[model samples]
Target: MSPQEKAGSGPAKAEICRAFSETADAYIIYGNMTDPDLYYASRFLASDSFTYILLASGHEILLVSEMEKNRALKESCVRDVRTTGEYDLRKKAAACRDASFGYAGVIEELLQKENVRKAAFPYNAPAFLYEGIRTGKAGIGVTLAKSPFLKARSIKSEEESACIEESMRGTEAAMEAAIDMIRKAGVRDGFLISPGTDRPLTGAEVLTEIDRVLTEHNDLGDETIVSCAEDSADPHGKTYGPLRAGQPIVIDIFPMNKRSRYFSDMTRTVLKGKASPELTKLYEAVRKAQEAGIAAARPGVTCADVHNRVCDVLEEAGYDTIRSGATVGFIHTTGHGVGLEIHEQPGVYDNDHVLVPGNVITIEPGLYYPGLGGIRIEDTVIITENGCRNYNKAEKVFEV
Candidate 1:
């Protein structure tokens, strides 16, 4: 289903309307489905460019090409669904001999029909369209503004939360399949081999399994990480060789649902063979730190506070962090919000955003050692009134 149909009511539309009223007489976002703001505002996903305008007069319009006219009308929740053809797009293009100028004329005509005195465009709106409106006949006062849809999306609607939760469940299935493969693999020559084949288990093989399982669950993985040994030392290491035995294998899977376009993030570090004393210690520290970060996440707590809570756990356990000016050890932010995009708002780091209910985030804490490998544990969660609700129910086991 389209985002509009799934939402029942328009998702984020109320917040978008409020921002539209506060920012300018009218707020405009121009782009394709790639522009999260445009997609959120229009509640329609189109590959080609489109326009969504919200007027202070409480009117909203979605303008699309004739090719998408019927789809937008059926899939989008906006009351005013218009087509460029209705504005004599071809005639205007022929008159100016420039499609860009014709598109600008169409936008100007739209504002004129509504008597829009001043309008606002997202900071990332099409430069040509923005410039065209600025250099138009009506002289509409256009100001660049932040994407209101992004801010609105930070707080997910119920349907959005459900979509993310479903994706996380899919992630659990994929993670289980990967970990099970590692657990059942036979160790030989200090490396893991497939259960039935002599071929050494490769990152490529595990990643393929991950995607296959995710696809079965209506989800898809992209650049899913399966780093081990020295490669695991890098936060986003990419390795595709034989899987080493008795070393930490970091499997970070972040996948999006095919239908909802919502994402889920999760990470797990597991040792295929036996873990050394130091390796166990490092893994335990990271686990404790992640738990501390999740515990600190709540409606009233600040993101910085939650991040610092994790740092405190790591530091107390004798680890250097970015806070201590260390280049290695516990680097990177504690976590970040997750939703339509992998990274959204209410960042769980130095950002001073106060956590609020409905804010979906991830608490991923890790420690990296260039030569000694690394360990990371992560989970997606939603801030609740009292504390937080973890969407991930995957078992956390360090040694397979």
Candidate 2:
């Protein structure tokens, strides 16, 4: 399913107004990114601009650079958009009679005239903008609020779910392509051999094949993970290693769809020959832990309870790997909400947040042994009234 075909309606102004009513008079959904690695933040917040327009919030401005004006208009929902360069900063500052007032005073004056009182901003708003409002001598007060707008964004509407489902499908297809390439390359004695030849595949070659397969879909931002052997010990290892017979290969791929911006994350452990007894046991334990964590997800379970359940299962199976603590079966949180953002709210940790219907979170539980490698089984799931629905379609078995 393409993003165009699955794209659905988003939250209305009235809905957002209700969500942040007590938090602020108006929500300033700002996207301040120093890099363009993740392009979805601005688009996700644009939904708020559309809601504000419908609510008639006097004016909702999306300030961007001159270069971003055209792209912003095409992608954003706000009509009253402006570029920072268009305004004369010196003139605007001079307009304020109080020399000490500065640009903050000028902006406060404009906002007060519009009858705006309090404003809420995104979690990552710039320090200058925040300090300006905090120090501004305006009689109107500006209170900072960490409104979990993304939390509300996590629970996908039917249309949003479909968009993510399609992205996940694309991700799975790419993973299949990478795995097939690795297997058919005829790896031997820790060296990958090219098809119909004895030439060895470098660590770089495996990554190139993975990147080529994923980029064919276009919406993907970067190459997916293709960790092998010892590198797999680190949850987020960056370096790649050559694949060889009997060595465990962990191929984790996550890519966003070009049109919808919704992404899919999936991991599968592979091998060209039989896995060691210890490695196989670790794999079974992690798979069981992941399944147990998923079974604990429901409408009323607390995040801590779900996490403790996985911890208990892993400990009982004697697969717990604790470093600093007395025992550490799983070091990280059980999972987190997934949607517009790769990592969202409703975190499955030892926190106190209650699970609710419509919540979509990952249930990834694993064990890692230094020098021995690690195994983790992760899947995205939607919480239902009765249970939950798993979105991943890949099999979990590890075989040559």
Q: Encode model 1's per-residue lDDT on 351-374: one tens digit a residue.
A: 789888889999999999998998
- Clashing residue pairs, candidate 1? none
lDDT of 2 by residue, 221-309 (tens): 46566666777676665445556666666777777666776766777777666788988888888888888988999889888888888
TM-score of model 2 vs. true structure: 0.80
Best by TM-score: 1
Worst 10 residues of 1 by lDDT: 2-11
Per-model RMSD to reference: 2.1, 5.0
Model 1 residue runs over 4 Å out of place are 1-15, 18-23
User: Candidate 1 at residue 10, lDDT?
Assistant: 49
TM-score against truth, every candidate: 0.95, 0.80
Residue 10, model 2: Cα distance from true site in angstroms? 9.5
